[model samples]
Target: MKQATRLMALAALMIGASTAAGCGTSAPVDATGLRRVVGTDLIGARGATAADQRKIDRTAVGLCAGGVWSKDECERHGEGAR
Candidate 1:
């Protein structure tokens, strides 16, 4: 009975160690990868609201006006991919 308990404990520890080794934190997402217009803007770090379309539009215009990211990069990634 003691030996069986010890084996079970050892198995549990191995399983936990293996799982930890395989686990990883996911990378942050890029907004331009979004497929829908709904994702065009955001609010308070979440996402855009339909009621705030005009506000979002203005924000988008301001952002797009500067053209921070080069058009060449956008074309390389097939456009709208950030």
Candidate 2:
């Protein structure tokens, strides 16, 4: 019936909205990300590849956005990875 179709469409719209919201969410700063930030900040990303460096940078941004690290601190440490 038209009522059933309307309900199904509403459900689909909600599901799609949730999926899009999730995709927009940034990756969390987890334990591994923290370790990488600390290691690279203290020692340096001397042996890290370009991709690894990029990951570290992204982790720093996540940490900053999550209030784990201050923007100045992240910048001072070169995005938490020297």
CA lDDT scores, all candidates in order: 0.38, 0.46
Model 2 residue runs over 4 Å out of place are 1-47, 79-82
lDDT score, candidate 1, position 48: 38
- Flag regions of model 1 displaced more than 4 Å: 25-82
Tell me the tens digit of each residue's lDDT in model 2 across 29-80.
Answer: 4445434433333123322466544544554455556565567865763623
Measured on C-alpha atoms, candidate 1 has an lDDT of 0.38
**What CA RMSD would candidate 1 show?**
21.0
lDDT of 1 by residue, 6-82 (tens): 23433454356445545668643533322132233333322233344443333344334445324663343233213
Candidate 2's displacement at residue 66, Å, is: 0.8
